[model samples]
Target: MRRIKTRVFVIWSLIVVAAFSLVGCGSEKQTPPAAQQAQQVELNISAAVSLKDALAEIQKNYQAKNPNVKILYNLGASGALQQQIEQGAPADIFISAAPKQMNELEAKNLINKATRKNLVENKLVIVVPQDTKLNITKYEDLSQDAVQKIALGETATVPAGQYAQQVLQKLGLWDKLKERVVFAKDVRTVLAYTETGNVEAGIVYKTDAISSNKVKVAAVAPEGSHQPIVYPVAITSGTKQQKAAEAFTEYLFSAESKAIFEKYGFTMGK
Candidate 1:
């Protein structure tokens, strides 16, 4: 009986010794994460403010797939963002809400033209407060005396405002309604004015109106009234992280990103 017990103890000791040897071998063979990972790249993406929610979601999904890459966003009015890039802001990529900014950058050779592609499209819209009793439901309705205050983006620095201006001009409402218009710094601000009932009506992108519950879309600008609202994206010519910037720019056209954009009320650009 003692001999049997001694034999069992000896077998367990051998098993334990073998397990330790295997662990030691694995420790020597397994490479540290630092040794296996490529150099980390940080990409600064300057994009339109209307893209905030969609891009945030895309960023989360992309970083999960690319552990070696980090993303930072500089979001604001497209025209303002373009001016910053022109002034040598540290942006690796630029996504403009309208082609005007991207076109200007390409003319100045400030962007990698070859990498420029239309990313998504938006609709210009008119919105009013949800609880308002006003009968306003169209762009022309703003000309009514009851619509005393109107919100519009500043055309010089805001693409939505530029489009809104074009639509009003084409509809011949610009001259009559210009006086009542209160131009905001950005499209989101226009939405804010409408939400608070500070303005009887506001002009903004469909995406901006969708982001809020305090206001409801009153009208969609006639299709041919303005230039097509398309967002274009490209890597900046001065980007030091070209490899990473290109990777992300390419990812923007992927199916995963298309779903995210559509979910945010933006149609993918052809």
Candidate 2:
């Protein structure tokens, strides 16, 4: 009877060990691997007011090709844009209508010097209201008392204003009509003033005048009137999206992008 009891105990011990092993294997925890991270980037661009049309088109094309990237743009007078960038705006790239303001930013180390490139060229032109049939072609005609007020960008900092001042000086009309000039914050403001009849005439860019049917070109400033107009694009040093920003700077030089810029009356830069 004692031997039978011993055999039964051994059989029960083997069954218990087998049950324990099966439970350990069945209860093992399996955790799913973590989800893969998404690769999305946002790029911010601050550009001159003159680039509004071209930038809009370029943004569309870039997004179509790179679905992962999102672009945000700030467009204003070149001086104002430079001020914003200096004040720590989160700008990935900058496109300035004039080089002087860009040089100032570059001096302050606000933008990457190596990434700078002359993207396009523009021409200045005088404009008048569309409905008004003004035959005042020569720059000297602007000095006539009938002209009352002529609008231009503020010459102190605005590129368009500076160019206008130079043109007036070249034509020997600046001293005669200084008092009659209506200063605007930017070239677009000058266009607005002329379109609304607030000023008899305005000095803006040829590309600008072509965009608006509300005004007619009075004359394109002769090449000698002002320094050559060149647009420069640069990548800001503060950008967090370094690769995206660099790609964008290069995109400005792409032939497809140049065609879009030319559609807005911009000339190809040398």
Candidate 3:
């Protein structure tokens, strides 16, 4: 009986030893996190198609500073972007080229009112392919017989398109030129139409024309022709990463960021 009890005790002690050894090995081999995990954040930003180049520049610096955050941009007309937000698209930030679209979203309670801020201001311009002698020195020139292919964003949907219509109407040329208008899905597409010679001329934001060397600004739209072109940005309600969204929005106001925007021909809203 004593021998059996000793054998049982030895077996129990061996089991305890084995368990301790396994725990020690685990402690030694267990990998601590190499570094603070990049906060896995996905920020979906909807911006005006006109901002493609400028925002692309900002994204590089923004990502470098906030390495943990991932930014995805949905670039299109402000109106379309607003519609998407209203439909509950997964957008974290909304940057509209026109105040009306931002106001529309605000009315629907889709934006974080506290985070709303004016990001930049842009001027409208008529552009043509490089070296084109359309002699388009004024908006009324759009009505000329020679100018058959006039590309503009669809006025009903795109802010740029709406602005173009307003400018033409203000100049008393809307009625005559309405039929000649070639509607594009977005201002960028309108710019492309003119740049690629698909159309002879197009109206787009001056900043957008400067962003690409493929086109040249033919005329600056008169200041009184349309409402001020203001870009307002706000964090959307669908954002899971509110802090990251707000941070990115605020980054637009930073001096470094402002300079980058200015380099692309956008005036700081402030």
Candidate 4:
């Protein structure tokens, strides 16, 4: 009877060991809960629409190196994005096409001041449809009666629009041309309007103009016509993913990111 009991105990021990081994194998095949959570992290980035192409390239390169991190972009007018953030939008990072939007956020204590940095620069330009025969050769030509239905961003919110407004005001054309303006929500919208010949002309960033085959830059807004076109990047004060946001922000200033921006016609920030 004792011998029988000993054999039964050995058999039970073997069964228990097999069960544990199977569990160990299962664990090895599955990611740990902690690791799974880490891999699911999504960073929400709000950026100006003009940055779409360059930022998309940067996002691709960044994701290649950081397979675990997902970047979700909300591209639009800087002013619209600023208002969204102010209304408690779930944005981890903010990149503005102009300092005015960033400055407002900074003043409201909505952005983490320590993480703020100027990312790039752009030039405003007059663009027209590739097939256009308009005699608009310079910024001043927009004042002519022959040019009607010009597209510009809403000066109150869009940085590109605001810059264009500044230029028009500087050139003493704002009052005369405001009546002929078709306001766009963002620079990209203006580009589309110009590209499709929906408008006689549009004001947009040089970077934006170069990205499109349908639009030709008719003239570049002279320097000092407006406040400098600068892109400012910052981590939002409300972000829970501060470390990840910081990593992405720093990456924007890296040589790789700069190269991509330059390739897209953006000038690196000083």
Candidate 5:
């Protein structure tokens, strides 16, 4: 009878232990309501390639302050980003290198127009490989024989290329150099071409040219040679995280962000 009592006690103890273990497992699998509510949010930002360095630094700082927020960047030419957003890409914020791309989105009601603001400006520059001995010191020198291939972004989709086209056209070099122009997908590509010595010269944003150690600025396009180079930021109309996106957009204009941009050779937008 004592043995029988001992066996029953052991079974009850095992059942209690199993019950406690099940409760612990259930608790471990569930997140607190407050924690679930404060879940991490990812904001998708599509920005011009020229804004890459500045934006990346800004993102790091912003995330440090807002620990629950994560920023994902899709950097490319402004026009290409615009097209992606138009095609229903999951972009929370859009920062374009040119007003033209932003304007197109605004016209289509794809972005919150009220949220649109000019963020920065950049200058078009001619860059050459650091070790280049090419005599192309100025934009006009591209017409010289030694400078066979000049790299510029594809004008149709690249804002830098469009600006380069305007400068070249204004200087009466567009038609003459068009045949030798090595069109790139983006300004970074143009920078790469120049950096690798694949092209005698390339046109890119002053910020991009300065970012690379392998390239050096040969000339800057005179002001007014092209349309004003403005970087504009806005929240997309389709963004579900409007509040977070707006916060990010405002953070971009903050002193900290502006200083970072300036450090990268970008000027404050007018």
Candidate 6:
């Protein structure tokens, strides 16, 4: 009888141990795998204000595809954004309306050189209020006596202004138009001035003119009047989100991004 009891006890102990082992295996299976749980990341994109609409669409598309990544935009004048980055403001990527701001950052070693690339091309144009009797049909017309005030981006900081200056100088109208020019804080402000009829005319990008029905394109800057209007994008040297920033910048040059930009009147740069 005692031998039978010992056998039964041993059998019960083995079953208990087996049950615990099964539970351990089941618990291990229930745990989520590290690979399945992606780490969430945030990327800050400092882009030109002119890119606002296109980028808004692009961001929605990208975020839909990449649910784990969050994108926040810092849209403003390229020069102002460059200054902010230079002064240690937080930014992961920088997209300038022209190469001048990017060149300045590159010279200062503030940008990731390997990630730099020209993103898009734009045309500078003169614009006026949609319903105007100014008879402003060309760049030459901007110098006429009827044109009391003209709005331009501040040449010291705005690339559009710099381009306008170049075009004016090329056309030999810089000296004559200098006194009539009203310096705006940014290209969009120049557009605003024209839209509000605060200025008789404004020099801005063709893309900007397409954004508003309140303004009409007077004339496009003649080819070779200024440097090629190419926007350049790069990662900031001090960015903490290196890989994520690179991924977003790569997306900016992707076919989908190109389509969005084209829809907004921008031509992709080679």
Clashing pairs for predicted structure model 4, backbone only:
none
Off by over 4 Å in 1: 1-38
Which stretches of candidate 6 lie above 4 Å from their native place?
1-38
What's the lDDT for candidate 1? 0.92
Model 2 misses residue 217 by how many Å? Answer: 0.7
**TM-score of candidate 3 on Cα atoms, chains taken together:** 0.88
Candidate lDDT scores, in order, read 0.92, 0.88, 0.87, 0.93, 0.92, 0.93
Query: What TM-score quantifies how close candidate 5 is to the native fold?
Result: 0.89
Q: What residue runs in model 5 are displaced by over 4 Å at the alpha carbon?
A: 1-29
- Considering only N, C-alpha and C atoms within 3 Å, which residue pairs clash in candidate 1? none
Scored against the true structure, residue 101 in model 2 reaches a CA lDDT of 89
State the lDDT of candidate 3 residue by residue for 13-79, as single tens digits: 9999999999988986785555645467888999998889888989999999988888899998888
Question: Model 6, range 160-193, lDDT digits (tens) per residue?
Answer: 9999999999999999999999999989999999
Alpha-carbon shift of residue 205 in model 6 (angstroms) = 0.4
- TM-score: which candidate is best? 4
lDDT (Cα, 0-100) at 193 in candidate 3: 91
Would you estimate the TM-scores of all the predictions?
0.86, 0.85, 0.88, 0.94, 0.89, 0.87
Error of 5 at 186 (Å): 0.7
Can you rank all candidates by TM-score, best first? 4, 5, 3, 6, 1, 2
Model 6 per-residue lDDT at 219? 94
Number of backbone-clashing residue pairs for each candidate, in the order shown: 0, 0, 0, 0, 0, 0
Q: What value does the lDDT take at residue 265 in candidate 2?
A: 95
List where candidate 3 sits over 4 angstroms from the true fold.
1-38
Candidate 1 lDDT tens digits, 26-100: 987886667556668889999999999999999999999998889999999988999999999999999999999
